[model samples]
Target: MVKKFFIFFTFIFVSSLLVSKDITLKAEKEKEYTYKDKFMWLWEKIHDPKSGYLSVEGIPYHSVEKLIIEAHDYGHHSTSEAMSFLIWLEALYAYFTNDWKPFEKSWEVMEKYFIPDKKTEQPNMKYYNFDKPATYVPEYDDPYKYPAGVIYAEPVGKDPLSDVTARYGYEMYLMHWLIDVDDWYGFSKYAG
Candidate 1:
């Protein structure tokens, strides 16, 4: 009778283990399903498809960085950092779902506004000589003497990335350091 009781106890324990295992797996599957839906809505909130950019004041801004900074910046402001996060998140979504559209959309919107057009922004770019990218100035130890001590007389090294820049034909322009999302700080073109 004791042996029979021991076997019955073992059977009950094994049954409970199987039931618990199914519950854990169901929870995991539910979490994954929720995340897939989240990625979809997140893409909708960040960018404007109508204007095809993360826009400001009818002017197309390349990133959503400035707005985030305007909200709260913890003493550091960087558009590249913001863009990096946006791109990374999109890539992660793509990795999980095997969908590249959202990733490509983020990159496209960023480049469309961030990168300066060679024709519009740099009309004189073609005349630029790669051999002399810039005249070098000597470094000085003293802060007061620095400006006076500096001389732009040395020949600069040939620009190594000129070809690469030319291949892409777009110069990155990270400017308007702070984007006033609601025109809160008065960076807007429109005067109130």
Candidate 2:
């Protein structure tokens, strides 16, 4: 009886340990599944060409360029520039990845609607008038002629004008910064 009891107790303990191990394995699998789902959700939202503009969630590419142009006319400088930059960046990514559908769409919009008839000439002075509001312009001493410091010269009070180059340049810098940061953080583990 004593021997039997010992064997029985050992079996029970071993079985319990096996059950716990299985439970842990199942939990880990579930966790992995959940993480994968979250990743997919984030990836779809960020990279989906059809819905990927900075504002106007889920806007089609055909309309994105028109929207940016209108935004530029309306003096929504930041929004217009950001949308254009994002579209271009997305196009570049799609091209490299051999996903030409989004790239084509973005390019069509850029070509049809967003491309300026002419690039704005750089201001001779480091500073240019931001608007009616009197603000001192910052110096652009760099050889590349990239505008340094704030883009806007002054508050502009109630009135504003869309400085196309300034807006686009600012947006490009910001988008590059964000992509670099994302790469650094290992969020974009795979380079597309």
Candidate 3:
């Protein structure tokens, strides 16, 4: 009677462990599917060409039109606020496709929106507070200055080759480096 009870308890413990492992694996698989679904959904909404340029919902690409529409829909009409999502989308696309075209396009739009004036002074600055701790505090305010400038050729037609090099040169470089790091490791985000 004692031996039988011991065996039964051991079996139950092993089975419970197996069940827990199975549940964890299933949850991870579901999470992957969810991530892919989100990527696809956003991609489709931004790249649909026709409605894409107009910034309509359910398009598959990014455009000023979509950005404006999204801002108004969300009750914030600021262009910078709208482009924040656009920047993230551009980064995501570059990370996934290992292509720089999306980043270039994003840069073009950003230049048009932020730096439409060609005669702006060099090293023009823009500030973004990321709401994080300051690891290093500067002695002077100038040390904290973040320069914002546009380096793209003036848009003439459909050709973006020249503007690509001028506008997004630094961004393209940083993105290439970041993509390599992300591919090597990984990242996480909370529920959106």
Considering every candidate listed, which one attains the maximal lDDT? 1
Better of 2 and 3 by TM-score: 3
Better of 1 and 2 by lDDT: 1
Candidate 3, 1-192: lDDT as tens digits? 999999999999999999999999999888877665789677766576553332322112223332234423322122453455666877887887788787777676555443334244222322212232123323435744645334344332343333554565412221110111111123312101
Specify the poorest-scoring 10-residue window by lDDT in model 2: 173-182
In candidate 2, which residue pairs clash? none
Error of 1 at 154 (Å): 1.7
| Clash numbers, per candidate | 0, 0, 13
User: In order, what lDDT does every prediction score?
Assistant: 0.60, 0.47, 0.47
Residue 19 deviation, candidate 2, in Å?
A: 13
- lDDT of candidate 2 at residue 114, scale 0 to 100: 40
lDDT of 2 at 160: 41
Q: Write the per-residue lDDT of candidate 1 for residues 116-144, one digit (tens) a residue.
A: 45577667766778887877767767887
Q: In terms of TM-score, how similar is model 1 to the real structure?
A: 0.46
> Ten residues in a row with the worst lDDT in model 1?
69-78
The TM-score leader among the candidates is 1
